[model samples]
Every structure is written in structure tokens, then in C-alpha cells.
Target: GEAMDRRRSCGVADAVCDATDASCTEGAPEVVQTTRLYAGAIGQATAHLAETRLSWESQPRNIAIFLRRATKELIEPFEMLRDWLVSRYGVRIFVDPAAAEELVPGEATWTPEQRPHLADMIDLIITMGGDGTLLFVSSLFERSVPPVVAFNFGSLGFLTTWDFGKFRSSLTRIFEDQSHLNLRRRLHVTVVQFDEGDRPSQVSEYQVLNEVVVDRGSSPYMAGIDAYVDSQYCTTVAADGVILSTPTGSTAYSLSAGGPMVHPAVTGVLFTPISPHSLSFRPVVFPDRSVVRLQLPQSARGDAQVTLDGRVGPTLRPGDCVVVSISAFPLPCVAPLSDTHTWLASLATVLHWNDRRKQESLTSASYTETIAAARRAGEAEQAIDGGAREDGAVFDSSPTASESLDDRKTADRRRGTRRDRDKAAADGTVARSPAVARRPRHRRRAAAMEQAPELACAETIDDIESFMRHA
Candidate 1:
């Protein structure tokens, strides 16, 4: 079975005949090889502080390192990785001009302008920060992207799977054997600008991994946006903003705005409103093939800002439209050995999906006991009132009617005094006259809290069943 699985994933076009036939190889096909790599890392001072110790072993090879800026402590890891790669595999290391000046002394560097020329020779990408680093690397490539392996060195690591401890083993597996990959879809967005009495022209274009957000920037009034899907008019949204998200982005800002969570395997886009003025403006999911367009109305109170993957893009004036569709190329993300396990673990640890303190049991016996006690108290009060009325009627024509009335008054006074004493004892206060004694505030609050759940659970099973049927 293992042999068959290997042969199936061997990247060969033709099927293997038999193991003994000599043509069928045992492991991955010879076509797979990674000679040049493009490595990126988060160069923030905080990232270096978070990861105090960095150690790894790798063969020397030619690789490019991408970073914005770095501190002295953070530069050590990049230098270490570079030295390891050069010492083991005799690999030459490349870095951006700024990082090259700081970390890789005497090594050649590539500028931002030379990235397109450098992209052709890169075989794979290794990112050493968080999901943001991966997104930044994705933005660099305009065509086909090299497979990326990311390490979790940041707070939220939805994309970064591997840690520094397993970096060597993970890289060895990828370099030496067949590895599974998750193909993440990206969105292509184009902004169209219009001039007075002139045709609309393409102003800007960007490929985003997460989502495209159109929002009312610094505007106190709600944004007025017209939405369309596949050239058909959808609706005009008046809200704080609207998010158009890819499946990869469904768990990002979209999730915060009450959008549904979509599996990475799904190829659909999400349309979710941000604080919509109307409650009926619900989020909608469209097929990947559908083209979505959003335009700011002429009556809009302010200009709307278009952001791709949380980065600032073109600003949309009134009558300007933004078009979004699936891009031709998909990002090839290197999957951890246990894909589902890692994903589920991240959801629990990072996102805290279902993390909460265990709630006290709602259907406790104390609830029923409290309800029964309240009912008994109410019945006893009714009984006392009835007895008093009977006494009054019986003593109406008696010779000793005045004496009987006096006796009843004495009994009522005694009951009131006893009640006051009980209240004083419960409240840890001195016993006082009936006029001065008051009910403890906590008793009333406790009664209300106890009664609330009882009323909620008062429905019968038959009522629940009927409600379910109607629903």
C-alpha cells in the first residue's frame, strides 16, 4: 500500500506496470528537485524577542532572504541560517540590500527592481515569521509561485505551521521526499477610475491572498456602495464597509465581521457587510467563477478606501468601481504532515474558537427546588388570607367580638415581629421595630436570579416538540 501511494504521487504521467518490472521506482520521481530557495522572515524587534533561541541544520545552497528591517538580535538568526546553508551544501545566500548590509556582509544583494529577474531561478520559499510574512512573499510573485514552508514565530500563526525546532527535519523531508501541499486560491482586484466626459480607465491592480475591503475611510456617515455579481445588480449596501473575501480569507477579518468559516479546499468567495444599516443585508457566498464588482454611489457622503489583504490600495471616489475575480495562479502552501491536526490545533490555541470557562449546569436540581419553594410560599400566603377571612365572618355576631378582634390583632403583631427578627438575623443586623426593618437587597436579587431559569425551563416536552415541528 505504501509503495502504491508513493508511485501515485511520483509526478509521473504514465502508470507503473509492476514493482518487479524495474521501471517503477520505489520513492518520489526524479523530476522533483529544489536548488534555489527564497526565504523571508519577520525582522521586527518583537519577533526576535519572542524567539530567543534559534537553531537549525541544513545543507549549503543558494537562497535569497527577504526582510524589511531588523534589530541586532534578530539579525543573528538570518546570519546563522546563511552560514549553515553555505557550510553544509556550499550554497550562496542572497538578501535584500538593507538586510544584506546588516546581516550578510560581503555577500551580493538584489534590489526591489531586480526581484522579477531573480524570481525565475528561485525553487522554493521558506518564511520564518507568521502569516503576514507569507502574504508579503506572495505579493512579490506575479506569475507562478514557488512552494512555501512557513515557521510560526509570531502571535497568530494560521499559515505558519512549522516551529524552529523541527525546521531541519521539515526541510529535509521536503528536499528528500514527496510532500503534500495546500493550493490556496488568491483574488485579482482591479480599480477603475473615471474622469469627467471621459471613458473609465484601469487605475490599479493587485493580487490579494486574504480579502478586498471597501470602507468609508474617516467618514462619519455610512458608506453607500452598489454591489453586482456576474454583471447582475445585487444591492446597494449602506454600511461601515463591505468585505469581499476568498476562501483563504474567510477566517481572517471576514470571521470577525460574522462571516462563515470556509474550508481551505472550498473555492468560493464571501460577501459580508460590516455593520450594515439594515439587518436584512446578510453575508452571501458566490462561486469562484463569478465576477464581483463594487461601486461607490454618486450620492456618497465621502470617499471610500479599497484595501487588499489589509494593505492600503487605491481610493475610490464617487462613481468609481472595483472589480474582483479569482486569479489564474494559486499559492502553493507546504502542508504540515498532519494537516487537519495542525489546523484544528491552531483554531483552538490561536483563535480560541470554543475557548471559555465551563458554564454552571442549567438543569440543576437546585432550580427545581427553588421553583417548588416559591410556589409553596405563595400557596401558604393564600391559605393564611382565607383563614383570616373565615375568622372575621365567624366573630361578626359574637358577644366577645371585640375580644376576638383584639386576639386577632395580637396574633398579627406577633407574626410581624417574628418576620422582622428573621429578616434581621438573615442580614446580620440588629433586630429593629417592624417599621424600621427592611428586606435585604440580596434576597430579592437571589430570588429573581433563581426564578429566571425556572421560567425558561417551564415549557413542557410537548410544547418543545410542537415548537420544533413548527420551526
Candidate 2:
């Protein structure tokens, strides 16, 4: 009874006792009202933007809706953006002509002739689904290019940049025109074959945003492969096959096959060996503009399977060659408007750099401390860069002096040739001025030399001269 009375006096709720009053005693003071902080900044910002007016009439924007075909999970993300846009800017949502009516039904207007093909009508393309969906959308455009923003739904996606937990903030930022753009390289592939009588057949081409691989098609025998770069022999690979991948794809199959993890912004191709016989045959990176060719030996014992991105291509028989080169265009990916270093930082953080033992070494450190350390390191890097600039001034000046010396040499060469021409003209040996002699030098020589041979007669000589002038 004493304990119960004490608990009641203190306004403490006991497990065995039932009470529903602000104060334990009738005359006791009521508890003071207090508020708690809410970590819903993104949610609140998104709601605020939904209610605000959009400036599209004066700003005039083009929008794209990207969704996955297999999962159909991006409907919510798309609808959220769609409703917000209609409520604010009165922007119409366009869909694929064949799939528009059946897939997307809304208050937005559409025209048949002006179908939104992602590559055509839309200024920006939004991808909803996994990395596969992103790849599918990226494969649509052939020549002209547009930017894409991918909301990830795939597992282990290197291409998708958005996090599900922070999507609310990401969406709000994008809608408010506060985001970054990450650029990536793409590869173009062409498939060719011979007709029944050995004549060249029709050509089929594919554009891939990732990689193109050629390997033995589940055959028991090893693939006979020969590779060339710029018509120069690189190597004749005798392995499962070869993978010609872009920097973006280096983290895909290339990485699995012992290739480096290249950043998407890097302009290069990763030539990764897929299960090579030779230990010395390691992966190599070539300049972005290099043209790589893979050929199957005529005496090859097996047929080769070619894969573009993940799709399979026709089997390549002996004597067949696959040519690969970088495309003239690039794929523009949308990201948060942050420092470029953030991408690498995200990879390192998410992947957990160093090793398990090293990570355990820092287990006691707070996350805040780690972040502060990173920031301090960044500042140190800036200071080092400034020092490099100051120290490199003399090194930079040397290049200018070298360039001036080359320019002087060129000028002296020109001046000496002009003086030689002037001296020759004064001696009456070569009467043409330097400028006249320089003009059409080859053409004048050709005109004098191209005359048809004379028949050792005046009449033949006259006819030959006439023919040379006319020719």
C-alpha cells in the first residue's frame, strides 16, 4: 500500500495499476508539453513541392517516364511525379505510341504522330526498375542522345544511383532542379554474315550501354580467338572468349573476370580475358577511340557465342570476325548535384574499403569522426594541389619556351627559303617569286610532265600539246 501510494504520488504508472490522468494526484501539476525532432525533411519537402505552383509555362519543360517491363514496380514513382507535374505545370505525359494507351492512362494529352520514343520527344528520360530496365531504355536511341535518371530496383546495380530510403529527397531535389549529371560511355555493335553464295548479307547493328562479349557457346572445345587493334595484331587468344567493355562495364562481367573497377567517367575500354590459358594474359585498358577486332580462326574447332550487354547473338563460325569501336556519342546519367568525388566516395563507403581486419581496427571510432577525417583529408588535398601549382610554374614555363623555339625554327625555315628564291630570281635562273613558286607546285609540275609523247614530228608535237592542255 505504501509503495502504490508513493508511485501514484510520483505519477508513475505501475504494471499492476491502471491510470489515465496527467498528474498522479488531482492537485499535482500537469506535465510540460515538449516537441521531438522529426527526421522527415525529405518527406516534408516533397509535400511542399506538390502544393506549390510550377513555372513550366514560362520555363517550358519536357518530361519522360521510364518503367520496368518485367517488374512494373515504378508505377508509384512515376505517378508521384506525374501528379505533381500536372498539378503544377500542366505538362502532358507522353507514352510509346504502341504501348501508351494500354500502359499509361491519365489526364495527360497525347498525339499519335508525335510519339514519345525516349530518344525523340522527351528532354529527359526517367528510368524505373532495375539496371536491366535502364539498359533497355538506353538501347533505344541510336544517334541522338538524351539524359536518363534511374531509380534503382535491381540488386547490385552499378548503374542505378538512387537510394530507396532517400528517394523522397532525391525526387524533391530533382523536381526543384537541384541534381547532378553523371556521364557514361556506350558501345555500338554490328553483326554481319555471308549469304549462301559467299556474298555479304544484310547488316544488323546493336547499341549497348555496357559490353559485348564473344565466347565459346557451351562447347567442349576452347575458342580460337585473334584480336587486333587498329589493324595491328594484338594477340590470338585461346580461351573461353573475350570481353570488350566500356569503363562503365568494367565493374560488370569484366570485373568478375579479373578486370579493374573503372569509374564511369573514365574514357577507355577494358579488354578482359575470360578464363585464359596463359597466366601472363591479363586485362588491359585501351584508349576510348581504339578499334578492336576479334576473329575466329578458319580452322577453329568450335563456334563462338556473342553477347551484347546480356542478350545473345548469332553463333560465329570459323573465319568470322567481330569489330568493336567506341561510339561517337555518350550516355548522360542524372545524379545528385554534388561534388564529382561523391561518386567514388559512395563506392568506397558502400563497398567498405581496406580489409576486414582494418575495418575492425576502426570499429571503436564514431561515424562522425570518420566523416570529419574525410573532410579534413579533402582540405589537405586542396592545399597540396595549390602547392603543386606554385611549384609547377617553372615546369609550365619550360613548355612555352620549347614551343617558342619550334615556332622560331619554322619561321627561319620559311624566311631562308624565301631568300633563296629571291637570289635565284635575281640570277635569272628561277624568275617566279617565292609566293608564285609555292602556289600549285604539284599541279604545275604535273601539267608539264603529263604531256603525251611526241612522234618526233611537228604535227605530233602540236597534237600532244593540245591534248595535255585539254586533259
Candidate 3:
């Protein structure tokens, strides 16, 4: 009843609807129609394990399934899943021409040339394998991209969120209720070929899900690239290469180049120099709105090449420049409702963030006790030689230590003797011998002051001033 109501409200004619249905006559609300879905697997996997194909006769909603080539092992599971999707959900299925012969057997298939037409009609995209497979699917849709639900079937699944084991539950939730999606920004790259006069002659553009790299392809000499941000000259990079990355790409190649790990939600571009000749030239983060241009200098010793998301692009001559900026259309990635903070969890798992040996902690009480014991031993040794004469029965000082102290005393005595001699010479009195002069001037002054009790009584500056006044 609900299905008929939904179909009828979506502008299915009253002729198609039951005429006796009371709701069809009056105030029936309009409903949004769910349309065709596109699903595909990466072509590069050696063995395709999935089997079973959707039956053409019993399907309801239009669906397209893409595959590379099917091996004997893959044919059963592939067809089984396809049939299940169609029979359970009543979806019409489309297959790729390349794998249609092996998987579908007799079903008519769409070729690669029909991708443009297919892109327009597809309501959603389902990708199997890793992040690379998802990237391939994104490339198919040049214009607006349908939301992608990626299954983790390949190694290093930084982008793929759905697990193969829970595919049924994950798909059920998506179809039953609309889920929160992560909008990952993509980069728009333009390669400009400069003519004889160093003017732009030809332009080629590409979309990158990850980073764009400008590198010295095979030359022994470093790549010399002049970098500019928002038309303002930034710096000439002398390095193996330079990586221009988005926030989503920051965790990819840019992270390996010592760039900051930016969250996917952050709107920014990252510039990371690879093996930079100058240590001062490090990674820089720019606002998403900024236009980044990297040009190969005329003096460059080697041919520099550009790569978009690890896919090699045009090789640059001396005057060629590559312009990179954020694209207006972002990729809508369907996330599993179970794990909301997937990025954080992925960092811990994929990057081995928690893979560390447990460190041994010090026993605080034992450590403190050990330190105290050492200190007490030193004090006990000093106490054993009861404060004796400087050179007799005292704590045994090392020869070097004793010599250092004696030298210091000798220098102080010499200084005191020199001062006393100068004062005696001024007063027309004979200078004392070295033995007699060993006493410091301050000690002698103190003894002289003691002889006059009044001066001795003046201990402070105020008392001394009063004594001086009386004298």
C-alpha cells in the first residue's frame, strides 16, 4: 500500500494507480522518487570472488554493476551478490561490457563510451576495493558525483569505510534512512604549455582527489621550481619535487613529506617540498581560496614532470607552469553511521598510531631511597673524620682538589699583601714580610678596630656614621 502511495505521489498517472483508492482522489502529499543506482568494483584485482547476476525479469529499480574480468572462483559470489541485490530490492541491473561476457553470460552490457550517459542517470555509486577504486569511480563522473559507498576490499583503505562482512546491514541503513556524508574536497589542476615567447599556448586540466606533485623525473640534478601563491612570488624550490595537496590529501603524500595532517573538513591547500636543498624551506599551508602556481625555471638542469594523485601528467619544459586550486564540486562520501569519527579511528588503525612498546616506569619509592642512601654515605664519611686540622685527619681530599684550594688561598693572600704594602708605602711605614702579610687586610682592620672599643661597637652603617660624628 505504502509503495503504491509513494509511486502514485511521485507523479505516476491515476491510470497507473488504482482508481478506487480514496487517497488518489484528493489531498495526497507528493513524495520524492528514489531512482537508479550505479555499483562497480576495481578492475585491477587478480581474482574476482563474487558471483551471481541480477535477473532481468523481476527487478524494479534500475541498477548498474561494473566489474573487470571474472575468474571461475569469482563468478559465483559476484553473481550471487548481484542476484540478491536485484531479487531483495527489486532493482534492474546494468553490467560493464568488459566483464559482461563472463559474469552476465547473455545480458546486454554498456561500454565505456556510454559512461557519460550513465553518469547523468545514476542516483548513487557503490565501490568495492580500496580508496583507489573509489578514485576511479569519481573520475567516471566528470560533472556532479553521486554519493559513494565504498567497501573495504583492498589494502590501505583510508577512504573505504564499509566492511565486506557487514555489507548487508550497511546498505540497509543507507537505503532505509539518509545518513551523514563526508564531503571531501578535490583539486582542479591545469597544465599550461608555454610557447617560444614563454606565453601559454595550450592548456590541459585534470581533477585530483589527492596531491599534485612536480618532480625531477629522471635527472640527476635537482628540480628548480618557482612557486607562487595567489599571483605573489613565494619562493624557488630546489628539491626533488614539490607536492601541492588538499586537506584530504594531507594524510597521503604530504604527510610523508613532513606536512601537517589536516582534517578532511578543513579547507586548505598544503605545499610540501620533497628532499629540499635548503632546510629553511619547509611545508606551508595555504587557504583553499589561494591559487598555487609552480613554474619550472629556464635554468633547470633536468626535465620536470607533474603528477596528479600519483597519476603522471605532462612533462614540463623550462617555461611550463602548473596551476592548482580547489574545485567547486566536492566528492560526497557515504559514511557508516556506526563509526561517526572514522577518520580518527582510521589514523590509529591504518597508521599504527598505537603500536608502541610499553615503557618501564621507575619505582619512585625505591629511587628516592637509593638517592638518600648515596647522600647519607657521603655525609657519614665526612662525619667519621671529626672536623680536624686542614691538613690532618680530615676527610681525605684528592690531590687535585687540595691543590686547587691551596692555589685559591695563595692568590687571596697575595692580593691582601699587595694592598697592605701599598697602604704602608703611602704612610711611610716599612712593608711586612710575606709570612706576616699572609693575614688578610680585612682581619687586620678588624683587630685594629677592636683596639678602639668605640669603633668596634659600630656594627651597622648608621652606628658607624654616629661613631664617625663623635670622633
Reference-based TM-score, model 1: 0.63
TM-score between candidate 3 and the true structure: 0.61
Over 20-119, each residue of candidate 3 has an lDDT whose tens digit, in order, gives 3344445545433433222122112202101111111112255555543444544554577677777679766666565577655765556667676554
Give one digit per residue, the lDDT tens place, for model 2 in 286-384: 987788888887788988998988988777877677878776445656676432464566466545545364344445557667777677655643433
What are the TM-scores, per candidate, against the unseen true structure?
0.63, 0.58, 0.61
- Per-residue lDDT of 1-471 in model 1, one digit per residue for the tens? 344344333221111112223444445455333332221221222112111111122332446665534545456666666676666567666665666687556777766777764444455566667788778877776645656677676668887887767766666666653455555678888899887654686578787889999999878889999999999999998999999998778889999999998876677789999999998888999988899999988888899999888788888889899999977556766665444565677688778888997755657787777677677655644544553332113222222322346555655675666665555555554344444324354443343335334323524534432432343
- Maximum-TM-score candidate: 1
Once model 1 is optimally superposed onto the true structure by TM-score, how far is the C-alpha of residue 181 displaced, in angstroms? 1.4
> Per-prediction count of colliding residue pairs?
6, 3, 15
Better candidate by lDDT, 1 or 2: 1
> What's the best-to-worst order under TM-score?
1, 3, 2
lDDT for model 3 comes to 0.65
Q: Pairs clashing in candidate 1?
A: 59-89, 60-85, 60-88, 60-89, 60-91, 61-91
Span of 10 residues, lowest total lDDT, candidate 3: 46-55
Worst ten in a row by lDDT for model 1: 46-55
TM-score of candidate 2 against the unseen true structure: 0.58
